[model samples]
Target: MSCATLFPRLLGDVGGTNARFGWQAAPGQALQNIRVLACADHAGIDLAIEHYLHSEGLDRPRAACLGIACPVTGDSVRMTNHHWAFSVQALQQQLGLQALRVINDFTALALSLPDLPADSKIPVGGPLRGAEQAPVALIGPGTGLGVSGLLPSQGQWLPMAGEGGHVTLAARTALEFETLQVLQHRFGHVSAERVLSGQGLEDLHAALRCVRGDTAPQQPLDAAGITRLALQQGESSCLQTLDMFAVFLGRVAGDLALTLGARGGLFIGGGIVPRLLGWFEHSGFRREFEDKGRYGVYLAEVPVWVIHTEHSPALWGAARALDQLH
Candidate 1:
């Protein structure tokens, strides 16, 4: 079916904290009326969509596609980092849509990568370009961690969605080792997400404080507050937390690149990394990414790009999903 005929498709990129929506009126038409809504503000996906359509004064769409932060096995869908859950078939029926496609959020993100504007992505290290036919890796830390990729398949890009973020974490350095021990004690089997996400940032800060024995009475801080302290006020503890964050992120990103042979590129997404670009480009991210002893030479060749944009490119990915670009 021609995607152009699927006019006025409803596109959504739903995350843990926020859900961004857009309208693709036709195949070549730019996404219209993009809006970001707090997930907490709505009761469910159905309500959220209804609100958006009503607010925009848009008629019911012929088709719809949503990329949510969860697994879409069978018809049932549930978000991992948030409380929203619904059956795909039920939503389609409720909205009276001819088709409703639901997919993993990061998968949609991977789909958007090939069409990303050059200005939207800033390369961090290695060659400006990578192996043309090789796979690409993506890892991002936000309300939670999201990991995915795209591989060349039959002259097409196949996007992958898996829980790579939950893999067991590896650590080096005295502080790193001690912090890992603290995290393991608090939550058995420390996953990479334990130390790489927004909540992970807060938990990591607490763990570092516990490990370093700096029990000084101070105001509690979330990821944003911690970032402010480190970036603006030059707080020592927060600075160390971010440094360790870069080290672990680099290690995990390197591991993903090796696992997938993703020489095409390793792109960093999510809400956290882009915000830390000032400290990130200068931090140990690139160094640790290539810190592998035997694979150092190979990893050094992989490029890394940080995505920076206000609009969710995943919204486009959702539209692509509706188009069956798989």
Candidate 2:
């Protein structure tokens, strides 16, 4: 089957909090009928897709592709943050589609990297010296920390789908070490997600308060509350939390860049970082990203860009994957 035969394909990016749907009416055509629905409102993925199609008054697509938040290792898919679980084949059959592709959300994001428009991204640090053929790294903190990379091979971008976010975090300073120790004691394993994600923001704030011998509030602040207080209200503890979060994110991103030798560049995505753009520019993020002592010069040449595209790149990527299926 060719892309021509797969007209009116369904494309989706299903995150932990929301699910975005789009339609591709023809080959090489732009997506249409883009819609976002809260994940909580639907009992399962099928219902959400059904509701989207019904609400849009669109016909059932012959082919579909979804960039899902969970790993797509097998037929069974269980979201890490939500309660949705189903077999890919079963759902494909239920949707009455000729083909269905399910891929990691970060993989979809990575796949869309090459096609990202310049206006959609804002550079953070380093010179614009991206190698034409080198790998590109991607790291983002959203409902969870997502990590992936795009390796150029045979003139095609291959997306990695590793669980790099769950890797154990490293601390560089005494204060950072103390905070990690506190988290380790509570969570047993202190992955980067423990300090970089939304819930992680709350955890870091609460832990910093404990480490500083500050009075503990009866209840901890949520991620949004902390961000609001830090950005808008100028709360001391919230400010500290945001600073620490940016620094930690820098370290993790640098580590990934080194691991992948991402000389092409490193791109930051997800729902959180874009909101703190102004603060992130002045934070220790760039300093720590280039703080790799011996390799500081090497990293200094590698640029970092934060993706700020209004449209969903995951949807574009899923559409790309569906195109490849032909």
Clashes of each: 0, 0
Q: Residue 300 deviation, candidate 1, in Å?
A: 1.0
lDDT of 1 at 301: 92
Candidate 2 lDDT over 115-157, as tens digits, reads 9998888899988659889999999999889999999999999
lDDT of 1 by residue, 53-160 (tens): 999999999898899998778898889989899999999999988788899999999999999999999888988998998999999998888999999998889999
Candidate 1 segments exceeding 4 Å error: 1-4
lDDT values for all models: 0.91, 0.91
Scored by lDDT, model 2 comes in at: 0.91
* Backbone clashes in model 1, listed as residue pairs: none
Model 2 residue runs over 4 Å out of place are: 216-218
